[model samples]
Target: MPPTVHDRPRDDRGYPVPAITPWEDGRPQFALTDYQRSADCARQRQCSVCDVLMPRGPVWRVVGAAESAAIGAALAAGRPYRNLAPTLEGPGHRACMLYASMVCPYLARPNARRALTAEHPDELTAAVVRGAVRGALGAVVGFADYEFAVTGSRVLFRFVDVIEYLPHDNADAHLAELRAELAGHGGGPARPVG
Candidate 1:
């Protein structure tokens, strides 16, 4: 039997959220529990066992004026500060910075470049897997270039690429699934398989 809703994890607050990746059957393999000591997660915490920095706030629900803008506009413009209810500039526009940094083949870190080091030859490279999984995820939703993070062995989502106004096409359904995955409602506490 799967864990009950009570088995779910939470944040600094007492919310019953899911683990990033639950210990399930067949999935990408990652251990999220190791970071318990390092991360500032004690309140409503469960381990991803992989040290994933998931979205701390709300799940992204992208919307646009008529269509999604490009990745550039969304992040820079704040006027839509919930002020512009529906603008073509979608969420991707705002979160592009994160992708340009985290997913880049080059040094993604903004201020400094870490040496091209630690080759995860033995198993799944978290970042690489993240990109792939996110890609498939976007395919399901009809978008691209979403910024993401991992936690509790699952891909906890914080943001989505809404620019290009594409994701908005089926925003409701897609958002629901993505949010479910991030919240650990996607499945069991299964570890990644690699």
Candidate 2:
């Protein structure tokens, strides 16, 4: 059974994305990804955005949702989540829960399917928008990917990029277009990542 969190909308996939917990500054505050995969540094650091290191942590898959009930326990104990793109990149859908939490308003919907179609699914919507927005603005610059955990009104976007991905080289103009797309959804002003 899922935890007794407040109701929220689901994405086209039927998965629910709730608002962030511990609401900060009125809006749900996302954790924002921060991968620690610096080879240049010393201590064996790993990315928190994409890697999942739990007591008996399951190997990560692209778009894999962290057990909703388990999120609090996992974080309280302190674990690292890794993006599972490399292993799960073989075919089909290319969605990640980490990726979804950030920009997909639909993912948080209770009936994502009611809002999505065969061609335009939840993840597809997120990717197209995020890829363009983040890709252009360059905030995608820091993370390979990230995770989402919500409580009452706060959202945590734990960045988890490491071995599987690298930083974007430069910002692009199409970024402006991407920002516009994102604005239509997340209830925010459209702007470039830079």
Candidate 3:
């Protein structure tokens, strides 16, 4: 079975520890990307969640509604969206993506707001904080081939040839169904390729 919130390691604030999240002064900075680890994951073709080597395939990414709409529009127009828009987080296995969607405060709760800290003065953090304040309607999970791009000191993923997109209004229900399916299969990771 995929690990539950309680099953995963927790930070001082009881937040589930994301595999690739950077730690600062013993705290996980959820709003920031760990550039070195992100680069390593990209180079090694690893799942950002489980840190396992993912087979060559379309990986899963969780994005906000704005990005989803942009991608959808780009697809309808028969245009590529990768260069115009890039994701901050790396892709992961399907199970890991679902698990993160189910457990992450920002993804799971629309009312969850990211508190701005003086330490994080970057534009990315500012953007995240603004998004959180406005509230999110839901999350979109997309499967696609991705390439890494370096912008300044940050590493970003530009998704290409997206095969499918799943919009989830209720992450809890979605994850429960996924968990049940995995349980029926004797509890293993679900790998999907384009």
Candidate 4:
């Protein structure tokens, strides 16, 4: 049987392991991306979570509330929102995206703050710093045609003609349900990781 998102192997800190998360010194670094895998996923139009090729059509992505609102406004104004902003992660299947949003501590918690470590200084680290500055209330799942752009060693996604956007109110209620479910299974609420 395929493991549910809650059943996936977790790191020492208990974050579920995503297929695209990079490993370093034999440990998964949830904060970093494997650039090669990211590029390959983009090239193959694969889902970041499941690593399966997605059907041709709108690709789904999760973005901060601010970016989502901007994209929504642009779509409403009939303005070209494509390449208006660069996304850190590649697109994925809607189900995979939702599963990720549900399982990921940062995305699930509206007031969640990203922990910045000074040990690794890289493009991703800079991006993390930027995200911390902007602050995130919740996230939005949106679908659109996308093109990949390589900036340094990172693969960024630029959306074209976003068709729909679903804003999550931080999923607080859903998270409570998930926590209860986990507890029923003898697992507890997901622990915060740095």
lDDT of each: 0.28, 0.26, 0.65, 0.62
Residue lDDT tens for model 3, 27-119: 887766688888888888887776778777667777765676666676678766563455568888666776777777667665666655425
Off by over 4 Å in 1: 1-34, 37-71, 75-111, 116-155, 160-194
Least accurate 10 contiguous residues by lDDT in model 2:
86-95
Candidate 1 per-residue C-alpha lDDT over 1-194 given as tens digits, one digit per residue, 9 for 90 to 100: 12233344533454333333223343321223123232232223322222233233321223222213333244346322122222111122112212222332222222222233323522333233222222211211123223333356323223333322223222233344434545667534322111
Model 1 residue 52 CA deviation in Å: 17
Q: After superposition, which runs of candidate 4 have C-alpha atoms over 4 Å from their true positions?
A: 1-15, 75-80, 117-127, 130-137, 172-194
Quantify how close model 4 is to the true structure by its C-alpha RMSD in Å: 8.2
lDDT of 2 by residue, 44-79 (tens): 222222221212111122222222223323334655
Task: State the weakest 10-residue window (summed lDDT) of model 1.
Answer: 85-94
lDDT by residue for model 4 over 32-63, one digit each (tens)?
A: 67888898888888877667777787666667
Give model 1's TM-score versus the native structure. Answer: 0.19
lDDT of 1: 0.28
Q: Specify the highest-TM-score model's number.
A: 3
TM-score of each: 0.19, 0.20, 0.74, 0.71
Full ranking by lDDT: 3, 4, 1, 2
Number of the predicted model whose lDDT against the real structure is largest: 3
Question: All predictions: root-mean-square deviation over Cα?
Answer: 16.9, 18.9, 4.2, 8.2
lDDT of 3: 0.65
